[model samples]
Target: MTMQRRQFLGTMAAAGAVLGAPAVFGQAKPRVVVIGGGAGGATCARYIARDSEGAIDVILVEPSEVYYTCFFSNLYLGGFRDFESLGHRYDKLASDHGITLARDMAAGVDRDAGTVTLAGGEMLFYDRLVIAPGIDFADGSVPGWDLSKAEIMPHAYKAGPQTQLLKAQVEAMPEGGTFCMIAPPNPYRCPPGPYERISMVAHLLTQANPSAKILLVDPKEKYSKQGLFEEGWQRHYSGMITRIGPDFGGDKVEVRPEAMEVVIDGEVERVDVCNVIPGQRAGAIAEAAGVTDDTGWVPVNPHSMASRADPKVFVLGDASAQGDMPKSGFAANSQAKVAAMVIRAELSGSKAFPAKYSNTCWSLIATDDGVKVGASYEATDEKIASVDSFISQTGEDAALRKATYEESLGWYAGITADIFG
Candidate 1:
């Protein structure tokens, strides 16, 4: 942790003094078990621990030693961010907030008994549980694509070694060769992610392989901020990118990884590189805990993000089926804060505030060129509905786009601190 982050933590502690320390319950501090230390789980654990001021016992269950955020990962591909910048350790979350970091996978959850079983056979009893396991791809969502063949056609959506693999493949493409991407269906993690990835790849190829062509085989007829993306592509990378939506042979797609071929609408096309983003569902833990509905996502109370099946278990981030909120990291972090407040009120004596949430997703179309869409949300009895929204307009001046990109850098710094600290 840097001295700046340490100073921020000190200021946070000082603020806690003004709010009064949380009331402890019984002989032991109430325990909160958070699974998957990504955007949602980490933020929830940190807020509960920091705001409660030692009144709640927080345990973070994550398999990895460090977390790599899916957010800003496209910037890495565009050479605007380094791989290390995307990784965050749990040291500040544990040391500053007094959270117990358990680097272990949660294997099972016995909601009826209020206990979670770990992969190492240890059982943890919890007064409250938070499930924020992000996303897991559905099996066979893309025909003939599976985990075993990821090395040949890297999804690179998870922001780790796979991301590195995909970048390497793009850099190694033959001169004037074709690069193909099969975009995912609707309601996947990061609605604008696939398009941003296309932008980054195009930026790279402009200098490295200027004659290279990009093929976007997409299932959706239209995508998030389609006009803005189309305008940016035309302005910055004209004649190099082609998009085929569902009406134009994008829906009927099959991959042949062994032979490096993609069959679109009964026509086989060979490519030098392939990127397949399959359909997604909530992480496996949600289903294992029996919180998911027929839609493969956990249904929650929009106001508190409490699991509909069990109020004691809350689902956040991409795992949830909350309405009108895109599954971006910003949305997940916003939902975490709301859920943490509710959990703290139930476990400790912290006051619960009315649930208000917000998110903004920024994408880089080229160097110093960024576009964004965002909204504020309010929770109703039925769902978390959008209160107001905005998006980048096409034909915006370069100066404004550059400012937006710079603002994204600041947001990235602030949010990482918010989650890790």
Candidate 2:
């Protein structure tokens, strides 16, 4: 179900062939307005701004000045790395790539008028629009769970303030304190992200307070890298890790912040730290723009990523419903590249050839050891199917594990360079 990193590059090489010879078309550069400067939006902005030379005016709207990657953020929360390491600057995207970075959220979109409104009431028009605002939690799904409760329990999955709050709670916990984690339903961002987090926290507690344990409430029977994660836990903190599954009692996952307790089925919660990775919907911007269907996700063409409802607007990353692909940072970054290339060709009056996309997500199970999964995608009438994938072995090999750790840094550096420079 997953593709490995090495196989992804090979698939891309083959993809260019099936796409036929690249066609050349002549046209003036068109202005691009990109909303959300996360992995997907930022990468698209940089490529359009740079490849179009001085012809294209790229404006990027993002509320935050700096982006903290969600890929290895668990390491920071576990105390294995500093927060600064995950933070990235946008100077290259602005000064070097000539992208006009707007430091505000896109309040509304007037599709009929072809204009977008900023939170400050500023209006901007674009020849083309790219929406990649990441994800928003389904706050209505669970009863009595809202932003206020999120402030207390801290989902840290978003990789910003939540990450800091979780770290602080862990640091202040008593030696024998229990840490509770509530996993969301299937089809969410970073499928293996939560398990990797548990692995890192177990590693940290082994040093800081070995008596502490993690109480996991999983909505599904099995999850991404389930076998590998269980093997690592057995070798590391087998007894300290107690997992509750749907059959065993995972259905009881719910929380009350005022009581500072989470109920499992009908049981009272008792934990010093808590994290609930809630179910997710599309980003609020997508809903406001009326691009989402009942599921709150935009529908798009599998090849060009053009919205089915709106041709001038393209949806990428977690915001779009890309069949069979996980909602992941790497996937978003990869999708951005493909979407940008298609837009480039479209603006030049050239036809969009069938393009292939691939993504690999690396999760650090410990300081020197990491696990990864990846997949390659191709367009079809039914849906996108996996071309290839790879996964790390259960028990780590001395050489391979070390290479994965190095590869993680290489990935971060490469993606950052591709997006910013």
Candidate 3:
């Protein structure tokens, strides 16, 4: 079923290039400039260019040439997958879909002028814009931890090199050493991410340094799939993982990267490695474009994923403040489809469909032991609200858990193809 979908989509992209390339108007085609080439932006760019044929000029402004997904990085940490497997390139979007891949950082957005300025001083004029730049760390949100000292305590939130560093640090921990993780607060990207990281780190430590301790200092009172995670932790890594919630001094935390120490509620604990994920907001380009609200995220129309601040722009993924949808890679890719459909309908006179979205987040607790949480969502008058939801149950049979893990592997293969192709 997944391969069929991929082949059909691939054919559509190929057909669009051949059948849709004639100039709609003499020389000037409607331009679409997409910023940030992650799940949302890459999918949006591919769909707009592929579906529109040659009616719209699609420009993807991304700083990095290769995008490493954060979704499966925890699996890499757990030794389920290699680091190289998480990386993806945009060569197909350019070669197959005829997208203009602008390998440069977007410096600013001139909404009134309909132009985006790159850091290299090139200006791209667009009739419509899509902003899917993902999240940025808030200034001074985590005391004593900032970008300058990232080497000492890597966040590993963005994937790529930081992920390698965090994995290396865990592998280098002394026997029975302590590994501390400072989890982020509410409304951040991937609610289940930190817990999954803890699980993966614990998986690694169990084999390499069985006596090592894992500490989770989290600001949130409760987390996504808490029951499932707690069960898995007890079943696979008993007495190895400890989570401190806000009521237990998780909120009041500070780090000293130089000394490799964490101060929690005025109590100091020295640790061998620290992974601190600070509070986050919409990416810098969204703020520069005046699309984000006061809460640091972009408010968008639920039906079209169009920015509420400006109808000419759309925001996707973690940067959007749409209600009820947890920010996951699946959600981002789902939202991108809705945005792409809307843009195609607006520009190319294509038929528009009602917006429906879904997401599933898979977390690996141990080798071949996986759990998942997922939901289906619909665009309501107010926001995108949950229609139905499901989660893996505690005490499920090992065979079922393994099957769920296998399902996620297929999904990862399908989604990466859907986004990149």
Candidate 4:
């Protein structure tokens, strides 16, 4: 699936007397098309516009009028943030930064014709393409899950309607009922995300319905910051939260939407509210474009972010299976800047300096505090690997808890600036 027709052409292009072998040979301000302006595409568009010296025509394709990043949406769910705070306008990305914004989804890619077809039936020709369209649920990965009834038990992974749907269910949860969270296995986006979400929601339920319980149905035996997370949960929530791991209860979901029961071990555990975050795969667009890996993530050159299938394309963020680097808004924003620099060098007929990268992800453990993970990295033969890292060491005092709380907002602000502000 990975070997492409361009390998021979690329080899000849490298061997021949071409002034520029890697980038567009003679195009001025290479017209680049970017899909999904959420975390990766928006940041990439902004950087290309900000630093490309007007030698790149940046066009962003997105369907949403405003984007609410999934990373910070937990804050909104915790009642710490107004819904308005999470909304980001694309006008700044389009108007201030000179990026051409398209409000439509990419429907098809005619690579040989250098065109990307839009959901509206418009054909956009590009000198180069960057796809950061994020992930999609593997259709019916579990027996009871399907598009027809995703409305009943929302994933909240998309962070808009899913957010609202899940919120309504949480509010409607009976005073002493159960709320369950089904966490997908490893290689999923935002490794530490769902646990942090359950933590925040559990905190909310502590007040709204003190007798409420949270059941975490996890596929994996362990999770990101497994030790730290459990420590925090036990200290704060204790009996309020219970997790079922692979060995004891197993992770498979035999979903029965009509009855609202997720079967495990031949038993039906009906819940007042269910949040099933199923196994994920690259957005179908990546697969359709023929850039996906065996695991359904895009394969790109670690250094250039160039697709192994089409060198003219660069894939970033959650859509690309960049190991070690968690699929996160911060990571996407960081990679966006790097991809911009590499594309800039290609446009200028120069090579980008050895790529060095950084990422920090902050998740709200509760309204009072947040836990963080951060790392600096460089590309390796296989993928972008980390050089330095930090994880939350137990929060010691009230002042430190306050500090962690404020730090999440600061990180969100700084990352928003990096991407769209």
Report the lDDT tens digits of candidate 4 across residue range 1-421: 0112244235324643321222254634467789888788888888887777667777787878788888878777767777788888787876677786676789998778777777766566676788988989886666787667779878888888788788778878998999988888767889888888888788778879889999898879888877768878888788999888888675666778778887886778988888888889888888888889788888888887788888888888888876678888888887887888888787656557887778887767765666677899999988899999987777466567667778878888888877876
- After TM-score superposition, the amount by which residue 319's alpha carbon in candidate 4 deviates from its true location, in angstroms, is 1.1
| lDDT of model 2 at position 178 | 90
The 10 consecutive residues of candidate 4 with the worst lDDT sum are 1-10
lDDT of 3 at 23: 29
Give one digit per residue, the lDDT tens place, for model 1 in 1-421.
2223234335435654321132245446678989989999999999999999988878788878779999999888877789999999989987799887766789999998788877766567788899999999999899999999899999998989999999999999999999999999978999999999999999999989999999999999899989999999999999999999888899999999999999999999999999999999999999999999998999999999999999999999999999999999999999999999999898766789899999999999998889999999999998899999999999899999999999999999999999997
- Model 2 lDDT per residue over 151-261, tens place: 778878788888888888887789899988888887688999999989988887888889998999887989998988898788768799999999967976678777768
With a 3 Å backbone cut-off (N, CA, C), the pairs that clash in candidate 4 are none
- lDDT per residue as tens, model 3, 1-421: 1112234335435654421233245556777889999999999999999989867888788878789999999999988899999999988998898887777789999899888887866666777899999999988888999998789999999999999999999999999999999999888989999998999999999989999999999999999989989999999999999999999999999999999999999999999999999999999999999999898999999999999999989999999999999998999999999999999898878999999999999988887888999999999979999999999999999999999999999999999999999
Residue 224 displacement (Å), model 2? 0.5
User: Distance from true position, residue 302, model 1, in Å?
Assistant: 0.7
Off by over 4 Å in 3: 1-26
C-alpha lDDT of all candidate models, in order: 0.90, 0.79, 0.90, 0.78
Candidate 1's TM-score reads 0.94
| 1 or 2, greater by lDDT | 1
